[model samples]
Target: MEIDLAGYDGVIVSPGVPLNRHPIAAHARAAGVPVIGDIELFAQARSELPAHKVVGITGTNGKSTTTALIHHILKTAGVPTLMGGNIGLPILSRDPLPEGGVYVLELSSYQIDLTFSLDCDVAVLTNITPDHLDRYDGLEGYAASKARLFAMQSPDHVALVDFQAEADHAVLDMAPDGLGCLFLDDVPVEGQENWPALQGPHNRQNAACAIATCRILGLEDDAIEQGLRTYPGLPHRMERVAEKDGVLFVNDSKATNATATAPALAAYPLIHWILGGRPKTDDLDDCAPHFDHVVAGYTIGEAGPMFARILKDAGKTVTESGTLRQAVRDAAAAAKPGEVVMLSPACASFDQFTDYEARGEAFRAAVEAL
Candidate 1:
């Protein structure tokens, strides 16, 4: 695509467009045109917009939940709020936030790589794990991509790095005068378990991060806890669907990897585990610690046979259900009272469904149909 760049000052591309490999991006660079993402554009326009605060959140997992939680907390605390970036609308596409408004953005690694000028008022890293290995040099390279969020922030801006990583600490130091970093222990959440919508240890950590972010944003104690109790969690991620005669059905289809699935596995006991799809790994070894809790393992989709072999080899009750409908049905049929029929496929849903949301909706529909 050849074009004159004199009329336009810059070009903004989506994060999915790999600038390193995409020819159009190179062409834009060749023309001496500034090429960046929506986030950068937002940053450039900030001076012209109303006075506001921005909270940028990123991680391998929990980005969606944490972003939503922060947005909810800010809203509950009576601060005008808008959400965008990775979870919702593009930042540039939206109008400037109102005075005293806060923009809570769920940024992905790809988005962060494309964004250069977004110095968030409050920047947060949920945690870093080996993910998108195909996109970066290795684990360290991926971690560095997350670190870029802090690097773009002003020294006076607050940084909340929840996950402990010595390497991440060093990289974030690149931020102007090092970041005003905040850790989990700095926040006080006395009875984190009391929040039902946010169950499990991971959510507790997420809660702590949100609590700290809200306090930094000037939220009072009552408002923070109110938001925590009222914050409706994101769909397709540890979503509780239904319960039938004491049997619970959970749809956690967003667990596209083992790390994402571990929390769901830990959240329940006596689970009629429903898992499979296009396999990211050959086995469910990451979930070994929770095997005793899985009353039976029902496999489905492209990875059904592979998961079945692994489960059988591990001396577990394994069934190659081969389809989500069958797996849910089988699990529902086998589950006794007080047991959980959980659909937490720790693999991509592309083999059967369009995406994780579609997969989760199917799981919910199947459970409701029972």
Candidate 2:
């Protein structure tokens, strides 16, 4: 719906709204209304309020969990904080903060594209990967969009980067040379041993980024540790769905690409992996390194046959389970003791479901039935 924000403060929209390709951009431009994202709206509203802070997080993955962890830490320390943007409620929908509140925003590339003047107190880039490439022209264009978050900030802002790969390195290499960039590799990953939910190398990177962000925000070390220990992981993203008959069921439906799903595959061994959907890119070659972990593959959705062919050629056992329900049942039946039935579809969900959440729910329900 087109909003008449004339004389009103501003209009807040879902980060998924493609302003560059959507009518909202033209309408807002014609109305002289600055096309600000939810994060920008939150930043603007914070001005009239008491002393509040914002931590903006953007990356190809781990954004939701990192944002939640930051908010969890702040709340554990008795600081009022809200987690919003791509993680939870729309930023503008929340009631105004009273005083000394913190806003942890999980920003997507589209949101960052719309946001121009938002100066986050703590800005973070988890890692950049080949994602949403159709929206941008190529990988460089996509990285450029992610880079805009740090660019919009002032020299005083702090950036947490998880330089995962050469692509991430290339993105960080263009960081204006003098910006305050905290590399996750430089952070000590030792303290996170106490946090089980934050397991795996990806979560370690996430923990390091969150710790750096909280530390930059002046959060005490004790409080940060407490938050890390108590933080519950986000749903549908590396969530432990069920364990039946000695087999573990992992619902990493949020992994819509090879880079995102690769970490989960690396986390486990002997996986009866359920993958395939509306394929994101041409190849799953990035995930090939983890092929030793996959004992059998259950393919589903539009890319089922294609993935089956790919796996078959790779000498991996494969089944073209056309639906999520069938895929789950087949994988469950085929899985043995000490094996993992993981739903890490390295593709988008639009082929058979509204989104990844629905696809994940369907996987859970199917798993429950088995």
Candidate 3:
């Protein structure tokens, strides 16, 4: 099948399409048609919509949680809001938000590549890590794409960035006028222990970003605090599924790399960790600091044997379950009171499931069957 770009002004493609290698990119280039994505279309339509603001969040991890947190806080404060771009419904397909509405978008690097002029009222870079390297030139290229979010923002607009890592600093460097000056410490997020859904250092950072953005938008402390307390967490990312015989089950299937999975391991104690899918990294060095939390590890999917050996060598008890259902059964059977059976696979889900959501659903079903 051939796609003719005879009279088309541009070719719209999914963010997952790789412009560096895809045939559509070449065809579009040959036809002198600009290759764009939904985000770009949304950007072009913003002038015709009602009065609104946009918050754009992008990072290697934690962006979904942060995006949802902001939207939840806005809704709680009685502001009209919609979350899209990466975490929710398509931006263009949805109806125009009413006046004073905020569009909180979770952006990826690929989407950023195609979006030329999305001037967010509040732009956030959660954190930059080495993931999705195949889509860009290298880690630097990926970081640059994330930085473009801040670059697109007007100087009067707020840019909230996490300057924790060297790569994050690099992202700031690439941005216009070094806008990545805001830190989590700059804003005080008190009483985090009272927030049930937000736990661990990662969530704390996410909370800081949300709090900062809300404050910039004129939300008071009381409203932000209430929103934080009542905000329910998203699925496939540290969601509590069920409990049986005093053993809790957690689904963190969205932790598709070691950096994302490390915090989940640190959040709990006596964990019967079920991990392994299509391999991302050869070694789990980022997760090494939290290895003591694992009571035992169940290896499954494409990376099972290698992960089993790695865990064994680390002096941790290892079970080569090779499948999600078997791993859940073994972990559940072995888990005792006060222990957790958590699925925080630090790899892609293509080997055994359609996506991370499917993997998380399978974890829930297996837990329910018990």
Candidate 4:
């Protein structure tokens, strides 16, 4: 990681690099070289690529789904599109799209912090919540980082923000005039019921944001609807893995935190909720409202005992299963007809698995085994 920063325009780093404390950032700063991310690199190269619109989506949760959904809609309408940024591939790694194409990017707050000049044609803020507190000053600082995506856009461009879950009005203030406010309830329930991948109130907002972004991109309603109906959905985020004897198995391993897991819990009525992992927060305050939806809880990984105690205190039946496989088996065995055996752990998978994707694959494998 040692290199002279002479004659370099800027040091490009991944979103995970904490510029606030990383020595690389300090070295780059001392060398008078700015540290930027892939999104900024893509912004600089935009003029070289053929005429194409960019959609930048940022928030604590649902950004990935919204980004993928928008990409799916554009493709469904026969428009050439590529999804990158914080989701799949780095923006600079992918081949440039042809004319009339759209680049849908799921930007994290960290990426947005390092990105300076990405003026997205359509920018969406799904919703803001407390996350990555160690990276920024606090929740306000984190929210400000997300707000920069819209601030980088032009006045003529469209900015879509989810007003329903917006914790700070200041984020809306940072948006350009003629802002498009998306409310989850505004998205017709009947329309969403048909979208299997996009279930739960949170996905409703994700769908709403995608719909607004697609409409701004000049997509017809029919094409947008078709895309919503046919979005295969991203892995580990509300993915319907399998079904056994009328019991559905869902893999929501990307939750990683209670804020992300809360919506997944709300998606199913009778859930044998399997949760826990490397602990992020001591309390599941965000998920408390949906306690009634859980038929019982199976806890595992580092936070197993803690979550078991919490669920028990909340008057919900709890199983202190110490492993993902055991939690799956316990939930599956206890699950009755018309119940959902969901793996929506509200913590990171580092305690037992390499990452959330690996945890999700394990959940899928465990369900397949059943």
> Which number leads on TM-score?
1
TM-score for predicted model 3 compared with the true structure = 0.88
Residue 135 displacement (Å), model 2: 4.9
**On residues 1-370, what C-alpha lDDT tens digit does candidate 3 reach at each position?**
9888867988889999889899998888888899889999999999999999999998877899999999999999999999999988898878899999999999999999999899988888888878788888888788888888877877677778776643345665545663435765577778998887887788898999999999888999999999999887899899988889999899999999887899999888789999999998999999999999999999999899999999999999999998999999999989999999999999999999999999999999999998
Q: Estimate each model's TM-score.
A: 0.91, 0.82, 0.88, 0.90
Question: How big is the RMSD of model 1?
Answer: 2.3
Off by over 4 Å in 4: 1-7, 23-32, 164-169, 172-190
For model 1, residues 264-361, the per-residue Cα lDDT tens digits are 88877788999999889877778887787888999999988888887788888988898899998999999999999988888999999999999999
In angstroms, the error of model 4 at 44 is: 1.2
Residue-level lDDT tens digits of model 2 in 234-316: 78887878889999898999999877888888878799999999998878888999898899999998888988988999999
All models, RMSD in angstroms? 2.3, 3.9, 2.9, 2.7
**C-alpha-based local distance difference test score of model 3:** 0.89
For each candidate, the alpha-carbon lDDT, in order, equals 0.84, 0.82, 0.89, 0.87
On lDDT, who's better, 2 or 3? 3
Highest-scoring model, lDDT: 3
What is the number of backbone collisions in each predicted candidate, taken in the order shown? 0, 0, 0, 0
Q: Which ranking of candidates, highest lDDT first?
A: 3, 4, 1, 2
What is candidate 1's local distance difference test score? Answer: 0.84
